[model samples]
Target: MDDVTDRLAQLERDDEELVLDHFDRRDAWELGHRLAHVALERALPVVVDVRTPAGILFHASLPGATADNDEWVNRKSRTALRFEASTALLGTRAEHVGFDFFDQGWLDPADYTVAGGAVPVRVAGVGVVAVATVSGLTSADDHQLVVDALREIMAN
Candidate 1:
């Protein structure tokens, strides 16, 4: 439990540092490909989706990923965009608040999910401009992959 807490904390920190100075359609396309490449490199079947507040920018379903994974991507991305936090973190928050988010019906489970893999794509001055999401791995792994890729993308 402590380890999980520690990891979530680190993810929060990483999120803070990963904000982009600018993000555009090209960035979204490139980032989506990068995420897909990373998943392929890891031999992980995944679906990647990037979206802005207005609409989706980039979406890809890798080999071995299914329509189910696409659904997960949609729901998880909704969770992140609405909360402006990672979906996994939202799950932890739901636990801390002593509420079963689904049972409470606070959000329509059909449209939103508290599972991991969705990350808000924040801009340094503009707030969350989009979300970079990956589905089909453990929540923690999904979160870490986005964070790792963002770190690399932002650093260069």
Candidate 2:
């Protein structure tokens, strides 16, 4: 997690001037496309959903991604928003909450998963958006793919 944080911080610092000033819709779309492309390159079917404070602005799913995966991605984004953490953290919380996490009502049916692969997109030191995620690879692989995608986006 420290690694991810460090990378994110570095990206923020690198893009500080550009990002601090604004987040453009075109940039978001370009980022989403780059992310999806990375997923495809990995041979993992993936769905990328970009959501701002207002609503979803971009969504893309590579071939072989299912409707279920799409739903998972959407829920993952919502979970990120509710927890103010990455979807991985939400998944951990769900595990701690146990099988009844859903039953106990501590988890939102649309905002919980142990499957991994989702991440929140933050700017200006605040998590103002999220990227819904689904990957055909292992959960860790999925997460890494998203991280790689984000890195590539920031590099640009």
Candidate 3:
């Protein structure tokens, strides 16, 4: 949590700790709105998206955000959901391993990115069922913002 060395550990802990008993459309709505409201309260220009493998349950683009942010949400979410881990974790791991996403050959740049902005939504029994993503801030900031919101959701 203090530096890059700890980022991977923190992200992994987030994946393990931010577990939901269950998730559905209603849960997505609540969590998505929670993220959006926090961004709005802080006057952040961002897009927030929450979606399951079945489909998207909630999506919002705040003022000062654009379609580009939406695309980033898509890519980042895909990366997070693909591995059931946070985008930050993936990116950090890739860097630690000395291979960019392209060298891995398993990802298409258009559909997936290692950027840090998405966190998989894990259910207690169902595993990772969805992802909550944010865009328009720095990658780390975006990832942390989602993590904070998820923590809030878990706390309540």
Indicate which candidate wins on TM-score: 3
For model 3 the TM-score comes to 0.94
List ranges where model 2 is wrong by over 4 Å: 1-22, 93-103
lDDT of 3 at 147: 88
Error of 1 at 54 (Å): 1.9
**Candidate 2 C-alpha error for residue 137, in Å:** 3.1
Model 3 lDDT tens row, 2-115: 466687777777778989888888889999999999999999999999998778899999999999999999999888888888989888887776778777677799999989
What TM-score, to 2 decimals, does candidate 1 have? Answer: 0.92
- Over 17-87, each residue of candidate 1 has an lDDT whose tens digit, in order, gives 87898989999998898999888887898898999878999998888899999999989998898989888
> CA shift at 21, candidate 1, in angstroms?
0.9
Compute the lDDT for candidate 3. 0.89
With candidate 2 superimposed using the best TM-score fit, by how many Å does residue 81's alpha carbon deviate from the native? 1.4
Native-vs-model 2 lDDT? Answer: 0.62
Write candidate 2's Cα lDDT for 95-124 as tens digits.
543545477687767666646676666566
What's the lDDT for residue 80 in model 3? 86
Please report how far candidate 1 places residue 61 from its true position, in Å. 0.7
